[model samples]
Each structure stands twice: as structure tokens, then as C-alpha cells.
Target chain A: MITIKDLRKTYDGFEALKGVSFSIREGEFYGLLGPNGAGKTTTISIMSSILKPDSGEVLLNGKNIYTHSDESKRIMGVVPQEIALYNELTAYENLTFWGGLYAVTPSELKARIDEVLKLFGLYERRNDKVTAYSGGMKRRINIAAALLHRPRILFMDEPTVGIDPQSRNLIFEVIEKLHNEGMTIVYTTHYMEEAERFCDRIGIIDNGQIIAEGTLDELKKNSHARETVVVNFNNLNDALLQKIHSFGSDFKQVDNMIYYYTNNLQTELSKIISQCNDAGGEIHNIEIRKVNLETVFLDLTGKQLRD
Target chain B: MIKLALKDLRLFVKDKRSMLITFAIPIALITLFALAFGGAGNSGKDAKISLQLSDLDHTEASASAIQIFDSLKNVNVLKVTLEQAQEKIKNGDEACVLIIQKGFSDSLTAGKELPLELQYDEAQEMQVGLLQQSLIPTVAMLPFNIGNAKAVMRNRFDNMVKGSDDSVHTQIHKESDGLFDALAMGVMQGSGTADIGAGFFGGDIKMTKLVAAKKDNTLGLVQAVAGTAVMMLLFSVVGIGVGLLDEKQEGTLKRLLYTPMNPINILLGKMLSANVISIFQLIIMFLFAAIAFGLDIYSHLTGLIITILATAYACSAFGVVLASFAKSRQQVQGLSTLIILVMSAIGGSMMPIFFMPSFMQKMAVLSVNYWSIQGFYDVFWRNLPATGGTFLSRIFVLILIGTLLNSLAVMMFKKNILKLS
Candidate 1:
């Protein structure tokens, strides 16, 4: 479990983290979702004791990480956005080095290295230098290195960024397995789908603030934006669009497509299709979906997730 | 910390380019300097001074003088005509020329003054001095021969008149004949050339004696090896520093800080690796020199080991400080290259410090290489016994300065690198 209280960090004349705060329960996979320069890495850095925040306290099980750095950090592992591995060293060697720094015993260290190398499917190339590995393989080894210490909590910052889909799936599966095994994980990424699929709770951060934080359904329920229903027509006219707009104020029509945002998609679908038929337009298809994190983020921050 | 250092060392060892830069290049340079500066195996031969001789006198006395020059172990006499001798001296082919006058033997036998001509080029002052000193005793012995011949003849005539016996008269006359040949031989050979005429020409003709120093050539060999080795050690340390910068850029340094290890421990680990590698580099170089060239590095065992430790630590600390100040790997490389090369050149790595101008030699004291090379020289070349005075001063200064620099580097790393990032 981790608690970040009133974290504020400044660089030069700019404020990177403006009094952001959050917490993660044990055995929960929490994802900090944000775009580039949204200060997710900064928050992770401060919480992991890699960087000291200007005015904040990161408590690991009720111990301030900065004040009790070693004791607090002993139970944590961090996988940075970058590879953060020695290209000249083999995967096995890199694991051994990281494990050794955690003060793992020789026997335990060897066992852990073997386990992680096997887990990451890098056992076949364990002896090869990291420089000779593929990007996906390197990312796998990077995660494996963080796992060598068997920490209670793992902080992975954009672990699957720029990696192949296969590697990304492999990483997702690993994180799923770890979460199922009751491991506390704090995953950060800008990929809304990944956060939706993998994270138990998602925190949407923007401009150094946690703008939204909740489960997928909770976020959707909490956001004021309604579910969108998109109806495509073979032929659409302005009169029919106005009639559809009369059903709800939150409506827009573009080309042969009409969008309707309502609290109830099922109740609004039939009336919208009947109105389109009355206008002599044949309905092509209808799509009904709840608002996702991207919409929640956009509605809350007035910016796209990728922005 | 030890684990971190070992990991860094393993990484460096695994990288072929790093190994080449740290070890292979330095070894090649050591071998080159050894070969160029006479650091190969001892051949058990003292350096010889060459002399050009023109025997225009052609008499038995002059012939005997030429034979004396030929028989001397430290002098190599080359036979040349007067014109050839003059040409050789003008062209710097010969250090000096010795020409025997036409009436030299006649003048000597008549007990009259005779001066043989010695010609040399003024530009070759050192060679000219050595040749002049070598010839002094040979020239002074000429005047002593007349008095010795007169004494021997007087002894023979007194023995015949006193009626000592027919055998006594014969013995005295034979002894006088032997004395004349002995005197002729002495007059041709220089002092210290024949122990038979020891002190015979003392204080005569302001005769100069050559004092051979047993340490000069060996000192030169050690300086060449030590200077180059220290210079290359700096470059390798800079390489390690650049490696630190790379790790920092890649986020490994920050990741390490996230562990239970202290920031000081992280830097100390890197410093330890650099120091260990540098020390090993020096050991390999010294061992190669000793095995291949018979350099007596182990003669002062304590001094050599201590010098290696102090110098390695100091250079490694310097590298860490440089890395701490740099923001990128390329910046570290460019900055360290210029600084290390300048320090090495000024500190006597590319050439002997003594050969530099006096001000440059004084400035050399500021460089780590200067202190390291001087310490090695004290141990290997001067054979200063490894006592406290000779090398310990250098060791003390190195350790003190290294500690200060390393502390600064650690502080800078914690402030500028970790906290700022």
C-alpha cells in the first residue's frame, strides 16, 4: 500500500506536480493514466524515493519514504519508462546485479533470477548481452529485472511503451498474473485501453493534477457526459437532423451520421431510428456505447487523451 | 556497494570497446615506449663512446697509441684519414677527431713539446665533453715517459759499474729494456685504462675522469613506461566517467537510487569499479613491462603498490567529478578528452617532464599524472627504498586530493543529477 500526500514539485519556473495526491490499496493494480508531460513519472519518482518532492510525504505502510528511505524502499520495485539496463550485460547478470543491490542471498538470488528469466521467456537468451536482444525482449528483461527482488509493490512507469504488441500482451498477462497472486502494482501509461483492461482502478491525471480517479463503471457513472449513440444513414437531410436534435440538446449531425448523447441509450434508439425513417432516409447501422475513460478525460479536462 | 561495483566491472569487461580502450591501447603504447626508449631486456653492455683516429705519425709509438685506443673497452676507435676525419666531424658523423702529429714520436723521444690536435663540432657539446675527458689521461702520460726512460738507464749503468755481477749487469739491462716498453705503453693508454699505471699521471694536464651513473638508462626506461601508463590510465578513468553519464541518461542511475541503497553508495560503487579497473590496468602494464623488458618494478614493492592505489584513486575521482558536472555522455566524452589529453601532455605522458620547459615542468605538479609518474620513478628508477620520504609524500597528496574530489563528485551527483532530474 502507498499514500502520497499533497505532493508538490517544481522545476525551474514551472510546476510539474501541483499538490497532487492519491493512494493505492494492497493487491490492487492501479493505473495512472496521462499524456506526455502530465507528471505521471514525476509522481512515481517522488513516491518511489528516486526524487524528493518539494513539500510532500510518500508513506509506504505508514512510513515516510523520504525520511525512512531504505526501509521504505526495500519492499518496492520500479520499472522506469526507459530500459534502464546495461546493454553489455546479459539478462541474467542484470537481474543478479539488481537482486544483489536489494541484498538478496546468493541462493535466493539465483532462484529468483531463474524464475523471472523463465517468466519473461528470456531463459533461452539469458546469456546473451542485452544489446543483442530485440526491443520486445529487452522490455521483457527490463520488467524481469524489477521482479527479481520480489518486492511487495511494483511501480512500472510506461513499461510497455514503444514495445511490440506481442510483448505488450505478454507484459499485460504478467501483470494480470501478479495481480491475481495478490501483488500491489502501480502501472502508469497514456493508453486508455490498457488502463481499462488491466487496471482495477484508474486515475486520470492531467496538467499535474488527478482530474479523475475511479473504476471504469464508476468513472463513467460519475462523469456528467452521457453515453453517445451514433446512427449512420444512407441518405440524411437537415430537416431529419433537426427532428433528431429535438430529442436531446446534446446532439450533432455530420454528413450522413448523427450523434445523440442521452442518459439512456435503449430508450432513445427506437425514436431516433423512427424519426430518420420518416425523413425518407434508410438507416445503415446503429452504434450504442457507454462513455469510456477517453470521454471522461476529455469531458473533465477539455482535452483529448492523446493531447 | 560491492555488488554494484562488481556489476559495473562485469559490464565493462563484457564490453569489448571498453576493454580495448582501457587495456589494449595502454599496453600497445607501453610496448611502443619501451621499444623506443631502450626498455627491452638488458643486454649487459655499457654504452660505448665512438672516436675517430688519424694516425699520420705512422711511427711505432703512434701505432702503439692506436692499439691502446683499440684495446679500450669503453672506446671504439675508427681509423680514418685526416681528410675523412675532418669531413666526419663537419657532418656530425663523429663526435670528435684525434690526429697524431707527423713528428709526435720524434718530439717525445727528444724530450721536446708536442701537441696533438683534437677537433670537434661545437654543436655536439655533450659528445665533445665526453671525448675530451676520455683523451685527457692519454695525452698527459706523454711527458712522464722521458723521466722514466732516464731513470731506467741510470739504474742499468750503476749496476754495471759497481761490479754487482755479470748476471746483475744482464738483469739490469733487461729490466731497463722492459721499462722503456712499459713507459711507451703507459704514455699511449689513458688513466684507468691500465691499472699498472694507476695514479701515474694524477694531477697532470688537468686530466678529466668520467663518472658512470648506473641509474640514467634504467630511469629513462621506467619514466617512459610509467608516464605513458599513467596518461592512459586517465583516459580509461574518463571512459568510466562517460559510462556513468550513459547510465544516468538511461535512467539506471535513478533506478538504482530507488533501491534501498543510498545515493552515496551508488556513486561509491561506480567509483570503486573505476578504481579497480584502473588498478588492474596498471598491474597488467607493469607486469608486461617487467616480464618483457625486465623492468625492476618490484624492487620497491611497497612503493609500487602504494603508488598504484593512490594514483588510481585520484584519477578515478577526477573522472567521477567530471561526470557529475556533465549533462550528457557526449559532453562528458568531449570535456574529459580535452582535459585528460592536456593534463597528460603537460604532465609528461607524451614526453619526459624534464625535457619540457622549466615553467611547464613546474606546472606539471598540478596534474595527477605528474605525481603518479614521479612516484613510480622514485620506486623503479631511483630505487629510493620505499621509505616515507620518497613516495609517501606523493601517496598522501593523492589520497587527500582524491578524497576531496570524490566527496565533491558525490555531492554534485546527489544535487545536480538525482535531485534536479
Candidate 2:
């Protein structure tokens, strides 16, 4: 379990984190979803004890992580966005060095290194230098190194940012297995599907603030984001656009397509068609989009999930 | 082609490190070389040769000789006892010692050959030659100062007359000796000989050249090994220390910080690796010197080992300091190259420190190369014992410098590498 309270960090005159706070229960799969430069890495860096917050505290099980850094760090592992590996050294050697830094015994470290390497399906290339590894393999070893010490909590910051789909799926499966085995994980990503599929509880952070936090369904329900009825029209004019705008206040128009948010999609869809026919605008297509995290994110932040 | 050239020029101008290495390093190095070689408007006084003198005779003649040497504008005379002079020569502090033998004044008064002993180290063949030449004018003027110029000339003319076999040569020598006798008589009234040829002291002072004992290696080999080894070791350790920057760039340094270990441990690890590499580099260099150049490494094994260890430690600390001051690997390369080369030039790595100007010699003590090379000189060329005071003092200063630099490096690592600021 971890608790971040009013964490504030500043670089020069720019505030990176402003009164940001969050909490993750033990064995909870918590996902921090945010776009680039949304302070996701900064928050993870503070929690992992790599960066200090100007004003605030990160508590690992009720103990201030900054004050008890060594103790807190011993129970936490961080997989940074960058591939933090030594290109000149083999995967086994990198793991051994990291494990040694954690004060793991030689015999136990050796066993753990082999087990982690195999777990990542990189046992065959353990002796090869990381320079010789593919991008996906390097990413796998990066995660494998963090798991060598087997900390209680794992912080993965966009671990699968750029990799093949196969490697991404494999990473997802391995992370799922780790969660099932009761390891608390704090995952951060801009990918909506990953957060939707893997997170038990999700927090959407933007501009150094967490705007939304809850389960998927709870987020949709709390956000009050209605299902979207999307319709494309030909020969649309300003008159037709004004008429469509009169239907509801929650609407977005781009080019000739309009997205109408309505709780009564069935009734709104028929009325929109009739209005379009009366306005002499030929309808091209019509579809209904169910309310999901993407719509919930857009509804809460007024922007796309990646924006 | 012009566009490509302009593009390259733009890139080069943007890279400050490359610009510094290309322009600044060369200018600094040239200035250092000019200063060392006395080419930058030097008055030649700063290039004085150190001459150690021991007045065993203690006569007025010997005193006059000492005074004349002291008054020379380009020679520094240090009056020491015979034993002290010998010790200085043995410790490589003085290249040669001039001993005024007993009865030197009597011999000069009687116009017999003057008794003088010049004990010198043969290892410094070049300096010994220069010292020998510098001593000639002082020795030639000794007879004039002691009022024995007429007697010395008379003795020399008599030998010439006696050795001549032809009647014509004897007549010519007698007539020339009469002219010199009149001039000596006129000039001798005031105890002054204003002009004398350098050859006048050739046999007048029965000078004995005694080579100092226990020097077997050539000076060139000694200097080359010690100088190249120290300079290269500095470069190598700096190269090794630059790995820290590489780690920082590659994100491994951040990963290491994420661990439970103290951040200082990473710096210490880097220092340890650099020290290890420097030690191996010096060992291989010296071993190669011993094998190829027949250096007497075995006889000075203990002293060599102590010197190498201290030198390696200091150089490693220097490398860490360079790395700490630099923000990237390219910066380290440019900065270290400039500093190390300048240090080497002024510190006797490229040439003997004595060959530099006096001011440069004083500043040489600030460089790691000076202490390291002097330590090696003690072990190889000076033939000093491992426990001798001079050798041990060098080792002490080296270790002290290493400790200070390492402390500074640790603070810099905290500020620069860890961003604790």
C-alpha cells in the first residue's frame, strides 16, 4: 500500500506536480493514465525515491518514503520509461549487479536472475550483451532487471511504449500474472485500452492534477457521459448545423459528422434523422458508440485520452 | 558542396566542446610550450642552471671561485657540504657537485694544476655536459681572482717551450710569452685579468670528472617511461571515468539511484574502477620499459610499487575530478585533454622540469604529473631507497592530493551527477 499526499514538485519556475494526491491499496492494480508531460513519470520518480518533492510526502505503508528511503526502496521496484540497461553487459550481469545492490545473497541472486530471465523468455540470450538485443528484447530485460529483487510493489511507467504487438501482449500477460500472484502494481500509460483492461482502479491525471479516479463503470457513471450517437450528413449547411445544435448542448461537430451525446440514444437517433430529412440534408451514415473510458475521459477532461 | 560545408560549419560551431578542443586546447598547449622553452619574451634569467658547490679547500682562492659562480647571471650556485652535495646528486636534486679539493689554493699559487673534483651523475648526460661547459668560465677566471694569473701563464709558457723541438717554434713561443708577460705585469698590478680564453682552464684546473655511483639506466629511457606512463595513465583513467557520463546518458545511473544503496556508492565504484585500470596501465608500461629498454626495475621493485600505487590513486582521483566538472563525455574529453596536456608540459612529462622556466617549475607542484614523475624518477633514476625521506615525501603528497581530489569529486558528484542541488 502507498499514499501520496499533496505532492508538489517544481523545476526552476515551473511547477511539475501541484497538490497531487493518490492512494493504492495492497494488491490493487492501480493505473495512472495521462498523456505525455502529464507528470506521470515525475510522480513515479517521487514515489520510487529517485526525485524529491518540493512539498509533500510519499508514504509507503504509513512510513514517509523520503525519510525512510532505504526501507521504502527495498520494497519497491521501478521500471522507468527508458531502457535503463548497460549495453556493454549481458542481461545476467545486469541483473546480478542490481540484485547485489539490493543486498541479495549470491546463491539466491543467481537463482533469481535465472528465474526472471526465463520468466521473460530471455533465458537463451541471457549471456548476450544488451547491445545485441532487439528493442523488444531490451525492453523485456529492462523489466526483468527490476523483478530480480522481487519487491512488494512494482511501478511500471509506460513499459510497452514502443514495441511489437507480440511483445506488448506478452508483457501484458506477464504483468497480469504478477498481479494475480498478489503483487501490487502502479501502472502508468496513455493507452486507454491497457488502463481499461488491466486496471482495477484508474486515475486520470492531467496538467499536474488527477481529474478522475474510480473503477471503469464507476468512472462512466460518475462522469455522467452519455452514449454518443454519431451521424454523417451530405449537403450540410449552417442552418442544419444550428438545428442540430438545438437538439442538445453536449454535441461535437467535425467536417460533416456530428456526435450527439444522449442518454436516450434510440429516441434521439430517430429524431435526428427526421430533422435531417426536414432540413434537406442527405444522411450518409449513423452509428451509436457505447460509453467507455475514452468517452468518460473526453467527458471529464474535454479532450481525447491521449491529448 | 557549399551547402554541405555550411551545414558542417554550423554543426561544428554549435558543439562548444569541439570548438574548445579545436581552438582552445591548441592555444593553451602552445602557450605552455612557449613558456617552458623560454620563447615568450623570457629574459633568460628564469632558465638558470642549478649548480651545487662544496668548498673543501676553504681557501681564499676557493672562496673567490664560489663567488664568481654565484655572480653568474645564468647559473644558480648553492654552497653545500661535500656530503650534502653528494646526497643532492644521489637524490636527483642536483645533476653535478663541484668539490674544491684540498690544496687547491696552493696548487694555483705555485702555478701547478689546480685541484678540483666534479662529481656528477652519468644518467643525466645532457645536463652534465651543460654543467661542465658552464663551469669553464668560472674556473678560467679563478686564477685572475687569486692573483695567480701571471704564475699560471708562466707555467703554461714554460711547458710550451719545453715541449717544442724545432728552433723556430721555440723562438716564436718565447717572443709570444714575453708579450703576455708584459701584459700580465701591467694587468696584475690591480689583481685583474679582464679577458681570458675558455681554453685557459682546460688543464690549469686539474679537473677530475667522477661519475656518481649506482646509475645503470639511460636517462632518456627513464624519462620516457615515467613521463609517458603518467601521462597515458591520466588519459586512461579519464577515459574510464567518462563511463559515468555514459551511464547517466543511458539511464543506468538513474536506475542505480532507484536502488537502496547510497548514491555516493556509485561514485566510489567509478573511482575504484579507474584506480584499478590506472594501476594496470602503469604496470604494463613499466614492464614494457624493463623488457625493451633494459630498465633496472627489479632493483627498485619496492620503491616502484609504492610509487605506482600512489601515482595511480592520484591519477584516478584526477580523472574523477575531470568527470565531475564536465556535463557530458565530449566535454570530459575536451577538458581533460586540455588540462592533462598542460599539466604534462609544465610538470616534466614532456620534458624535465628543470628545463622549464623557474616560474613554471614552481607551478609544477600543482599538477599530479609532477609528483608521479618525480616518484618514478626517485625509484628508477635516483636509485633512492623505498623508505628514503624524499621518496616517501613524494608518496605522501600524492596520497594527500588523491584524498583531496576524491573529496571534491564526491561533492561534485552529489551536485552534478545526482542533481542534489
Q: Which candidate achieves the best DockQ against the true structure?
A: 2
lDDT of 2 by residue, A241-270 (tens): 887666554678757877778888877778
What value does the lDDT take at residue A221 in candidate 1? 88
TM-score of candidate 2 to 2 decimals: 0.87
- In CAPRI terms, model 2 is classed as medium
- CA lDDT, candidate 1, residue A145: 83
**Residue lDDT tens for model 2, B1-421:** 9999999999999999899999999999888888888899587777788888899888887888788888887788889998998877776667788788898889889867778777876656677677667777667767766646656776776676676667756666577578667766766675444444345545333343344356678788888899889998889899988988888888888898999989999999999999998889999999999899898889889999999999999999999888987899989988998999988888888998877777898999999999998888778776778898988999999999999999999988999854632
Worst 10 residues of 1 chain B by lDDT: B203-212
Best by lDDT: 2
Q: Write the per-residue lDDT of candidate 1 for residues B1-421, one digit (tens) a residue.
A: 9999999999988866566557665675565445334455324232346777888889887787677666666566889998987765543335567777798677556544443676664433355566666666555554453324334344536544796777777776777667757766765775343333324333122221111113433545676788889888888888888887787778788777778877777778889999999999999998888888887666566888989999999999999899888777766766676677667866777776533333455677888888888677656644455664646777887888799999899888877655545
Provide the interface RMSD of candidate 1 in angstroms, 1 decimal place: 1.2
> With candidate 1 superimposed using the best TM-score fit, by how many Å does residue B221's alpha carbon deviate from the native?
2.2
